[model samples]
Each structure stands twice: as C-alpha cells, then as structure tokens.
Target: MKFTEELREENKDIFQAIFHHPFVRGLGEGELPEDAVAHYVKADYEYLNTFMQLYGTAISQSKKREDISFFQGQVAFVLGDEIHPHRNLCEYIGIPYEQLQGFPLPPTADHYRTHMKSVATDGLLGKTIAAMLPCPWTYQEIGRELKEEFAPEAEHPFFEWIDFYAADSIDETVDYLKKRLDEEAEAASPEDRQLMKEAFRKSCQLEYAFWEMSYTKEDWPIREEVLK
Candidate 1:
C-alpha cells in the first residue's frame, strides 16, 4: 500500500470520530449555533496563518524546483482559495473578515500550532509534510462526505465551507501532497517512516481536538492579565 494510504488506514478510528463529532454533524444538518461557528471560523483564520508558514518552511527545505513550486502553489492556494469559506462565514456571522484576522487561537489550536511549528522547523521534509497532511486531508474528506451525505443546498449557511473543501481543486491538492509524501517515503529510513506515521497520527488527533475546541469555544481558564 502507498504510504499515504497506510497513514489513513492507521488513523481510521480518529477520522471516524471527527466525522461524527457534533460540530461536523451540526454543519451537515445546518443546526450549529452561530456563536460556535463564529468561534470556529475565527480560530481557523488564525490557524491558516501558521499553515502557510509551514508551506514556506517546506519550500525552503526543498531542493528540487518541482518540489519548491509545489509548495509555493499550496501557499497560494491557501491564501486565495481557502479564504472564501472564511468570508462566507464572516458574512454569516455579521463580522468583517478583517475583524477576525488577528483572533487568537484557543487552547487546542495553540497546541496544534506548536506541534506543527516544531516539526516544520526541525524535521525533515517528509515528516514535516506528514504533520501538516491531516488538516487538508481531513477537511477534504469531511467536505466530500458531507456533500455526499447532506447534499447541502446553496442556501445552506455552511455551503461555501463545504463546497470549498469538496472542490476539485482541493482534491488535486491532496493528491499532489499524497504523491509527494509517498515519494519522500521511498527514500526515508524505516525510523523516519515510523516518525512520519507518528506525526500523522498526532495530527489526526489534533484535527479532532480542533473541532472540539471550536464546539466548546475553548479558552484559557484565566485572563492573561491574571498571571501578570
């Protein structure tokens, strides 16, 4: 089996949990509270900032023009195409997209960012990509699954969010990333491959946590000034 396939098979349980998570179900059923979704969109907007940074780190680590170009393309994709959902979400929330720009990530997202940053800064290209894969891959899967299951109408509040991830463009992006990871795996040591799997699993877990965070609107227990 391909390395990406293996990673998916290994993490099937977590993926299932995420699919069944209340926040995901609410999106499909068009029943999620406005506050919950607003919280999620704002946190995710901040998360994407770090997401693009990882792509930049990947570009810097790449030696081949094709690899660098691929990473660069992903950065553009995230910055351009991915933000449509945020805009739709902001409109739904009655907030300007710019207002959400500097929103702080809550606890789960902050930890997830810390994990990805560590891998992107210190790990080899394959492992770093592995850590990053769960975000796009899971969203693609979730989007496709929701589209197939719910057949959300264009009027659905979350339609743009669903459509964006389920788009052919996202499919192309995930396919490219999967192929890249498999190519990287071919040259990786067995130890490196194991590390990659671990990264993939942790990321999958965090993906689930991210949903939970948004569902709960996770926050630090005390005000930042309390400690000061």
Candidate 2:
C-alpha cells in the first residue's frame, strides 16, 4: 500500500471521528452557529503567520530543490489565494477577520501550531511531510464528503466554505502533498518511517481536537481559576 493509504488505514478511526464530529455535521446541515464559525475563522487567521513560518522553514530545511520550490509556491498561494479571499468572506459572515490582530491563542490552537513548528524545525524530511499532510488532506476530504452529505444549494450559508475545499485548486494541492509524502517516505529508513507514521497520527489527532475546540469555543482551561 502507498504511504498515504497506509497512514489513512492506521488512523481511519480518527478520520471517521472527524467526519462524524458535531461541528462537521452542523456545517453540513448549515446549522452551525455563527459564533462557532467566527471563532474558528479567527483562530485560523491568527495562525497564518506561524503557518507561513512553518512552511518557509520547511523549505529551508529541505535538501531537495523540488521540495523548496513546492513550499515556496504554497506560501504564495496561501497568502495571496486563500487569506485574501477568506478575509472577504469573513466580512460577509460578520467574522471580524480584521480584528484578529493579536488574538489570544486558545490552548488547542497553540498546541497545534507548536506541533507544526516542531516538526518543520526539528524533524527530518519524512517526519516534516508526515506532520503537515493531514491538514490539507483531511480538510479536502471532509469538505467534499460534507458537501455530498448535505447536497446544499449554491445559496446555502456554508456553500462557499464547502466550495473552497472542493475546488480544483485544493484538489491539486492535495495531490501535490500526497506525492511529496510518497517521495519522502521512499527515502526513509525503517526507524524514520515509524517516526513519520507517529507524526502523521499525532497531527490527525490534533486536527480532531481543533474541530472539537472550535465547536466548544475552547479557551485557556484553568487561567481564570488560577487568577482567582
């Protein structure tokens, strides 16, 4: 089996859990609360700086020219393609995207970002690719799956959100990521391959936590109690 297929098989439970998550269900039903959407958007927007760094750092760490080139292209696409349009959509949805400046990091958000940074900065090629794969792959799969479940009209509240993930561009990016993962894995030792698998699984676990956190509007768990 291909690395992507094997990895997915290993974590099929988490993928199912994510697909069955209440947040995803609410999104499919077009009944997800606006506050939840806003919070998630804000959290995602706030992380872009660190996200850019992660990719850029990965590009620098890569030994292969193709890897560097791929990451550079992604950095541009992320800033120019995704964020600008997402900012516009946030306006339509009353998400205060502009007000996300210096937003406080929720626990889950911080943990997720820190993990990405660790892998990009600390891990080798195979491990770094494994850590980053789940986001693009999972989101694309979930978006396409959710759309199939709901079959919503173009005017549906979350229509554009669904379309964003299901877009041809996103499909191409997912393909690119999977191809990179395969290439990276092929060159790995048995021990490093196991590390790569663990990284992928951990990233998937964090993906689930992020959705749950967004649904519940998670915050610093004990900060208030500590202050008191």
Candidate 3:
C-alpha cells in the first residue's frame, strides 16, 4: 500500500471520530445554526487568509535554500489555484473580502497560529512536519466522508472546498511529510523526538477542537435561523 494509504489505515479511528463529530456533520449537510455557520464561515475566511500569510513567513524564515524553494513553489500553487476553494466558500457564506478584515478571530485560531509560529521558529524540520501533518490528513478524511455521505452532484459550495483540501493534494502532502519525517528522525536528538511527539499530539487536539468549534450554537447560527 502507498504510505498515505498506510497512514490513513493506521489512523482510522481518529479519522472516523472526526467525521462523525457533530461539527463535521453540520458542515457536510449545511444544517448548522445560521449564526454559528456564519461565524464559522467568517472564522474560516480569516483563518485561510492568515494561513497564506504565515506560509509566506515560513518560507522567508527558512534557512535552507532547498526548503525556501520548496515552499516558494507551494506558495505559488496555493495563490494561483488552491485559493479558489476559499473564494467559493466566501461566496457561499455571503462574506465579502472587506468584511473579513474586521472579523474577530476565534481563540482556537490564535492557538493554532502560535503553534505554527513556534514550529517555524524552532527551525526543526521534524517539528514543522509534525505541526503541519494534521491539515492535509484531516482534509483527506473530510473529503472521503463528503464523497461517501454528502451530495454527489456537488451543488454545495463547501463540497468543492472539501474536495480540494482532502483529495489528491492530501496524499501528496502526506508523502512529503513521511519522507521528511524519516530524514528528520535520522538526524534528531532524543530531545527533538520528544518535542516532535508533543507537537504532533497538540496539533491533533487542535484539529479536533477546530471541528468541534464549528458545530457550537455559539459559533454557528444556522440553527437559530431555522428556528426563526
């Protein structure tokens, strides 16, 4: 089996737990409370924009030319093609670009950002890989669930976004990470291994929280809209 497939198989329980989470169900069906949905949509918009910005920062901060070049290519791909999913999501949520500027980021967003910054600043490729692993892995799992349980016609705007992040690109990202992890492990000290493991667990917890936050009455207002 491919490494991605192997990893997915190994993490099956985690993936199932996330997909079955109420937050993910809401996203799949668009059944979240209106205010909660809107809050989540707005939060997602800000999150993606910030994510792109931080990728730039990571690239610039990379001391190795190879790392810089690799990230530069990723940046170009994200800006050129990967951004369309976010644009589609913004349109679906009725959020304008200007509106996102004033949006208040959720506390989870801050935690995620701080974690990313720490990973980048630490300059350990293993730590960075550990921090980044959750994103593509989670996306791939979401895409699989969307395809299995959601609309096949792709009428929902969020479906595309899910497909984009969780489909083929996720496999690619995981493959890259596996190679990097191996390389980093070969060179890592015991302390580095401990740090990487801690980062990985923390990142996974954040991933779970991210999905949970999306389903709350406090964050999403779709349920209220339905009631009204």
TM-score of each: 0.96, 0.91, 0.76
lDDT of 3 by residue, 45-120 (tens): 6666656665666566567787677667666765677656656556676766456455656777667767876776
Instruction: Give the local distance difference test score of model 1.
Output: 0.90
The stretch of ten residues in a row with the least summed lDDT in candidate 2 is 84-93
Of the candidates shown, which would achieve the greatest lDDT relative to the real structure?
1
Off by over 4 Å in 1: 225-228
10 residues in a row with least lDDT, candidate 3: 215-224
Model 1's number of clashes is 0
Give model 1 RMSD, 1 decimal: 1.3
Kindly list the per-residue Cα lDDT of model 1 for residues 70-114, writing each as its tens digit.
889988988888889888778777888887777778989999999
Residue 173's lDDT within candidate 1 is 80
> What lDDT score is found at residue 62 in candidate 2?
84
Deviating ranges (above 4 Å) for candidate 3: 1-14, 53-66, 217-228
Cα RMSDs, all models = 1.3, 2.2, 5.6
The lDDT values for all models are 0.90, 0.80, 0.66
The digit string of per-residue lDDT tens for model 2 on 55-129 reads 887787788897799889888988887775356447556766677557777899899888887877665766777
What lDDT does candidate 1 reach at residue 147? 98
The TM-score of candidate 2 is: 0.91
Off by over 4 Å in 2: 84-93, 222-228
